[model samples]
Target: MLYQPDTYKIEQDLSRFGRTGNDTFIPGATEEGLRQYRRLLRNNINNTMVQAFPISRQVLPDDEWNELINLFFANHDAKTTQIWKLPAEFVTFVKEKDYATLWGKPWLNDLLYFEWIEIEVYTMPDIEAEPFTLQGDIRNGTIVVNLEYRLIPLRYPVHLYAVEEAKNHPGDYFMMVYRHPETREVLFADLSALDTFTFENIAHEQLSLSDIAAGLKLQFALSDQHPLLINMIAFVQEMMAQKLFLGYAVERKEQF
Candidate 1:
């Protein structure tokens, strides 16, 4: 009966505004009511913590729990029920600079952000075409590729760590994150090796597939039937089929 939706609303409201706002009518009654209300409100608040973040409860002492819960609920509003549906707030709390001192990890957010990106790339919609490699004159500046098939850009290195471990030491990295349309397998690669400039030139309708392939051959100094050329083509086909290649990006030329 106490946990009914309406009762829940009342309790939540008491937890939220019972201490802050003034009650005009029944001033003595309001003050007395607030005393009883805070007890129930604290219980309900702890229930939410039990449900949403059990780990915090297990690891934190009772005194610490109050601070942690209060910190999370400090800005909450009771009238709107939407806040209850929010994901566990511990992750955000632990990542904050102030909280990081408590958690003993400052880079936690960066690591989490990096891991989240991989989850994004793995779930990206299927790209129809497969990866295609070229061996034409790239060094001699003859290679061409679809601009759209250009290099993948990443602000953080998603490949260095698995989804879970990356949440500790996130760093900047750019590389391919590919997926095969049919098999749904993923791939990774370096942008420089794939020639990002050629990929972009092709993406923006700047070059034809044939011309691009020819350019690759020229740039890489390969003959029409070179073994290396054939291998390159096969590699592209595999990358495309499995969606192994992700995205391309240009490196900081000045870094060298």
Candidate 2:
């Protein structure tokens, strides 16, 4: 399109310039002006990627990070008009590129996703908490995890800023991230393997504290006085204070 002499092909020229390097000369546009234009585009994209994946930026070397950004800008086709969501597009690009094999940074994408989720949570629309009343006692009612929260079962503890700490831990790292309705603050909660199990399988509108404890003992051989149980209770109290509890149902639903 740049080689085409038709002045009417403005969109075509611009599109070509956006994808590859510019190969056209506008009537009055200086070469320096064109160079700055490309530079601005790259800088804008790089800035957003940095914003989207701050931790990833810190871990990756300059050459590799710049290459990844350039690769996405040149090849990845963005389907959305929302430029703020480009890093999300980069996630898709990484998966498609087989980033684990190609770049050998399997944990990098996990970190990117972790950081991206924080951005997503911050940008989520505000929701009013439904009117809720405790069923006589705060710890006895059904425990309902808020819909605004994300139960991310990650392979690495990307929440850890220290890369060595993230690297040493191996398996599924369970985390609960929620945005408070009133304060609009994004909060992080860690879930132990037992807590993760209970949240994944046992906690519901039908379950009470006793019910959860019973299920935990039956399934995981955890006794009533287990440290995990004690810690889990404390975690729930914290979550309630943070409004991630979403209050609770007054009457536990019939299991039959």
How much is 242 displaced in model 1, in angstroms? 5.6
Q: Report clashes for each candidate as comma-separated counts.
A: 40, 0
Error of 2 at 218 (Å): 4.7
> What is every candidate's alpha-carbon RMSD to the true fold?
12.1, 4.6
Best by lDDT: 2
lDDT by residue (tens digit), candidate 2, 1-256: 3455566566556655655564975667677867777788888889999988888899989999988888888888778788887777888788678775587676776777777788778786665544466444544556655667777878878786466577677687887887877777888887878667666543444456666666667877765535555666776677777777766655547898
lDDT of each: 0.47, 0.72
Poorest 10 consecutive residues of model 1 by lDDT? 141-150
lDDT of 1 by residue, 215-246 (tens): 66788786672454444445445543434433
**Model 2 global lDDT (CA atoms, 0 to 1):** 0.72
